[model samples]
Target: MKITLLTVGKTEDAYLKDGIEKYVKRLKHYTKLELIDMPELKNTKALTQEQQKSKEAELIMKKVQPLDFLVLLDEKGAELTSTQFAAYIDKRQIGSTSHIIFVVGGPYGFDASVYQRANDKLSLSRMTFSHQMVRLFFVEQLYRAYTILKGEPYHHS
Candidate 1:
């Protein structure tokens, strides 16, 4: 199974880039992990929150493939332990999942249409995180899950 991380905006921090790169290299050992960066909505200060989400949603939806399993990373979504996440990955592979896409929406969150398209929702933390930070956290968690699955020393119980 392949995992694709779709998130809005670019990760500008050098530290975050380095950290994400580390996990991306590690995740390659287990499954194909691709990162898709959605461009930020331009001049959105004039638009209302809802309008901004609607505009961003259009861009996000363009990246969605009919066969991809859309999973939104939202604070309101189900939270899972690292082990459980690894199990989730194993289950998807067993079920012959072609693509698993985890999306991090823009600041105001996803539109109703985006939510409707999602197969599942997952939360990295109950506490809020910036969309850019979520990319790093999610990639790191993916790496940790693989390490747990493979009995590697990277993840400590």
Candidate 2:
């Protein structure tokens, strides 16, 4: 299955960008992965949290195709171990799924519309991380998941 990681805003830190690139490069061997950075909204001083999320929702919806399996990287979502995640990825590859789009939303999190559209929700940890950091962590975990799936030594139980 082809995987797409669609996130809000560009990864600014040089180190973080490099880290994401490293795993993304390794991931090419396992599956096709696409990285999309949605532009951050400007002039947010006047908008309420809900309003910001609502506006962001509009942008998010535009990128989503009717057939894409959407997954949100949310704080309240199910948390899985690396091995379990591997199984999760493997399950999709075994199924008729063609595209899996994982979204990392902006600071206030996803709006109701985005939630309603999502097929699944996954949490990297119980603790919250920045949107930028989540991108890196998610990609690395994705790489780890693929490695685990391949029975590679990169991940150890």
Candidate 3:
């Protein structure tokens, strides 16, 4: 199965960019992983938080296919251990899920439409982190999950 990570805006921090690139390269050895950055909405000073989310949701939905299994990375989503995450991926593969799209929404989080479209939601941690920072954290966790799945030494319980 192919895994796609869709997030809004770019990663401007040099450290975060480097980390994200490293994991993306390492993840290629395990599965087809794609990271797509949706451009940030322009002139958001006048828009309310809901309005921003609405516009961002429109952009996000444009890239989603009808059959793709959408998963949102949100604070309120289910939290799982590294091994459990690997198991989740294995289950999806066995079920013949063509594409698993994990989305990181804009600062205000996802709109109601995006929430309704998602098949599942996952949380990296209970604490808050910047949206850009979350991109790096989630990618690293994904890599860790793969390593754990393969019984590699990268992850220790």
The numbered model that scores best in lDDT is: 3
C-alpha RMSD (angstroms) for model 1: 1.0
TM-score comparison, 1 vs 3, better candidate: 3
Candidate 2, pairs of clashing residues? none
Q: Compute each candidate's TM-score over C-alphas.
A: 0.96, 0.98, 0.97
Q: Who is ahead in TM-score, 1 or 2?
A: 2
Q: What is the C-alpha lDDT of each candidate?
A: 0.90, 0.94, 0.94
Per-model clash counts, in order, read 0, 0, 0
lDDT, candidate 2, at 124: 94
User: Which candidate comes out best when scored by TM-score?
Assistant: 2
How far residue 102's Cα lies from its native spot in candidate 2, in Å, is: 0.5
* Candidate 1 lDDT, 1-157, residue by residue in tens: 8899998899999999999998899788889999999888899879999999999889988988998899999988999999999898878888968899999999988999999999999999999887778889999989888888889998777
Error at 51, model 3, angstroms: 1.0
Q: Write the per-residue lDDT of candidate 2 for residues 31-137, one digit (tens) a residue.
A: 99999999999999999999999999999999999999999999888999999999999998898789999999999999999999999999999998888899899
lDDT for model 1, please.
0.90
lDDT of 2 at 20: 95
